[model samples]
Target: MPPVLDEFQGLSAFDAIMRHGNLGAGAEHLGISKSTLSRRISHLEYQLGQPLLHRQANRLIPTEAGTLFHQYCQQMLSLGERSQMALDELREEVSGDLSISVHPHFLRGWFNRLLTEFIEEYPGIRLTLTSNLQPPTREDDQVMLWLWEGPTRDSGLRDEVLGHQRQHLYAHPDYLRQHGHPQHPGELASHDWVNLIDRHHPDLVLHHPEQGEYRVSLPPSRFTVDNVVVHADHITHGAGIGLLPDHHVRTRSVAHPGQFEACLPEWQGPSIPVSLHYPFGHPPRKLGALLDRIRRHVPKDWGQP
Candidate 1:
């Protein structure tokens, strides 16, 4: 093996000189005197046993051998930088602050447990969670969680999808019994509709593998809720028939048996994807660790009914 060389400073000086094409500019850039910069280049050349640079008019030009040596020098400098960054990241992983902006809907389910467990496991991290109904806007330290639908939009932010949230029609047993259970999609129009806020579309669309697509115009709803829990509560309390996420329904069903039952179980509504977003680059070590925890602990079939 080649003898180990501890010449990072000298290598850096040479690289700076080559990049700037002169000793004056390179020394200025490195915040060193011309004499000090010249001494480093001389020492480096003596060790390598060749002239790395020569005067060509006003500028300093590298020789044919110097060109090859400069390439290696650049590689060494880059490796040193990357190595330092890795060490710094390792240090940051142990203790740092992380800011997260999450949609309020995500806090309703297993996400709270996930956050609780993460805080307990990694006490070093200072996690700040903010609630936002809109998509991310800035590229900074904060990581954002928002609802995604269909194919990803051309938003410049990078995202890691956690899971999907699928909606299906649900109603309380009492309401269905009182209003008479509807068998066909067309019969749904006669029943009272409970709409979620922002779902202004007149038609309710559903799809199936064998039966194809189904659409029905919704009548004016008696209740329009912005909060998911409130919306689910209204449906469970026999207020009206409404669309609810499968996961919420499952959790409710397990917690309180027969509270809400699926209506037209064969057909499925639109699927909303949950995604975590950050700026386009490697996330900070603290954020990276949290992301790893989410990926490992968050169940793949989290949204399944």
Candidate 2:
């Protein structure tokens, strides 16, 4: 005799009966008459060489063996569903709606270029992008591009560091000419400053290769902007000296010509980490393809000096 597990229909009947607690409802769920459902369960019991269920007044109660068998049936059904889903993913085309949340600065710069390339690569995938200062919630089915400044705690999400951006002190040429260039990091305190309200600190810190670290007390800013692009714009228009990511300054240089100049060539500012975060499991095929495309197009030294 073959194993009772080979008869999938028998397993379904038993599971439905157990779930509904009555043969009539089970038969309705399976779209079969109660008589036929009864025969399937009877056949299943015969194959196992035991009476699986005891018929009560209004319901079918599982025996000890029946309860154990029901557990196996549930596991089998779950495995089958997962196997079918895996097969479907393999056979299906990579096409779906991919929602992403990204920092506004990236949307304005290198990330936009990567997005164009990604769309060209996968014409079937529709992309929706939102710019936000904070990461998206789990309820939102969206991937996020995040800038991690310090050590990130383990959040059980999938986080892949794409690259790093080096922060540098920059001032517009007009501002530099008017205020005169600071020869050393220590002299930066006297300059008018444009600062990012969220990112900048009250005390400016700089690192020198030979001289080590220098901390300068910052005065009131000439202008403060919350958005990175706007912050860069303020610095480009000679609002004040601002510490900005190198990539942002490079992107801004295209339009502003030679309006921007690095203030302290020898001092290195902090490095900002760029990362991609998504749910911590097997991503859908379309999202996987987009992630691959981004990995290919985005500069390896994204936030480097």
Candidate 3:
């Protein structure tokens, strides 16, 4: 007699029991009752005409045959996973659940348009996009997009540099008209500043092609905001002069002309690299398609490499 497809479940149960060295732990891990787990293993033993596991001081120790069989079980399980992956790849259309976590800033301006287009293109795909500040930790999350400050040290994740987010001081035309527009970086000190709540004293390091670096200590912000969109809203609504991403400013300018413009056109802000991280393997078609879509349609002004 040959083992049928259903026997793989028993093989998995046996493997879990062997790996955990107890029925209780294995059952808990598999989300099954101990009795149900015992039945599966007992049935597996019955098929083999021998006892696979013996009780030795609360531990489920595998017999010699069981020990040899466990190794084959591991190989079988690995093959099963590969078979499923192969089937997914061979599908006629890219379709499946794709989950992505991105920084909150990425969700602002123009990103929605890209998302709308992606949904239209891949109607079969079930997509979940989350705005997250923390790094990706969940194994089930297929992709993550975040601001990369420095080199990545996590060996478990595979990452690709998407672009650099360059920021510069911006202010509303109304505010500039009322407060008097600053002609120099030194003149910027007197203006009210809107900043992130996390920053105790946000320093502006402006770089010029000709004038060089000018580090300015920002005055304590009168308006502190936690959200990036709110920060931009305040700046656009005459709250104060604030640093904003170049791409975001451009998008806002196009959407609401003369609402916001750069304080100093020549000087540029620090470029924070945006990276895409995924589990260390060949990404599924859905994830791959989305990545390709982003690369293809990302705004040229976004400063992607």
Candidate 4:
């Protein structure tokens, strides 16, 4: 069989069977009867020489091969729907499946809200948001959002700097009210300190890319959490004073003299790069639309809270 037609046949039949559990329902969906559906399945089995479905009581259950085939069929169908919807989006009428891979930290505020609004306005655009631990593998990733300090030399990735974020220390006014604000980074030890652990390393190793130094056995954790957002939340609730990015602490703190003051602001890096990476040239329709929407919506220095 030719590749495209063969792939389509496998996907469609797999889709039909998954959608309708029994052979009768699947046949009805395809405008064929149960017996014809059975014959087709039998022929498919003969060609592949394996049983796709298990013999059961009045219903068909997918075997292991059938399960894998169903997942592939689902992905293929999503691609088709995404293509149709993407073309519509280009007409200034948005539609498609906006498949994205974002880090856990980036899914805050406008990023979260943009997803909500994007789906609502362009109801045809289905979303499959996946968590990205590192850089994207596929060129079809459309837009990828990541935060890091300084240039990405030798990263072998093409991207544009969207914004620069500054990390600083923050404490609730209530916490500061009870515990006097530290005067120096050295004084960071005196309080009930909380820390965000880089889960990739949990032995309390720290890296200050700005200073080109490592502070091992740091992040004294009366409380230490893996996720930045959770650590930020604990700080917000006065769990303990900890370091956080300036933009992320905005939900609760007013930019003022006494509240959430940075103890050693000078010690922080010269703004970390918050960037968007995508394949060169015009992005796919859904991704292009999403990328534009993100730049328009996101704040200048939001991150790592």
TM-score per candidate, chains pooled: 0.82, 0.69, 0.66, 0.54
Model 1, total clashes: 0
- Clash pairs, candidate 1, are none
lDDT of 4 by residue, 198-273 (tens): 5312232223546543333334577777667788777767766666767766653553334455545555523556
lDDT of 1 by residue, 1-305 (tens): 11233449889889898899998999999889999999999998999899989998989999988899888888887777777777667756445666777666766667778878888887887777777666665544345333332345556777677777787889999999899777877888899888887753488788877989888888888988777788888988898888888888887788899989789888788877777666676667766777787778755555632
- Pairs in clash, predicted candidate 3: none
Candidate 3 lDDT, tens digit per residue, 53-168?
89999999999999988999899987776766666576647777776676677675566677778888888987777776665443544454333322345636766777777888
Cα deviation of 167, candidate 1, in Å? 2.3
Give one clash count per candidate, in the order shown.
0, 3, 0, 1
Worst 10 residues of 1 by lDDT: 141-150
lDDT of 2: 0.77
What local distance difference test score does each model get?
A: 0.77, 0.77, 0.76, 0.63
Model 3 lowest lDDT segment of ten: 142-151
Determine the C-alpha RMSD for candidate 2 after optimal superposition of all C-alphas: 5.6
Error of 3 at 124 (Å): 1.8
Q: How much is the lDDT of residue 201 in candidate 4?
A: 26
As for model 4, its CA RMSD to the true structure in angstroms is 13.6
Off by over 4 Å in 1: 1-10, 24-52, 64-76, 139-155, 302-305
Off by over 4 Å in 2: 1-87, 142-156, 254-256, 303-305
Order the candidates by lDDT, highest first.
2, 1, 3, 4
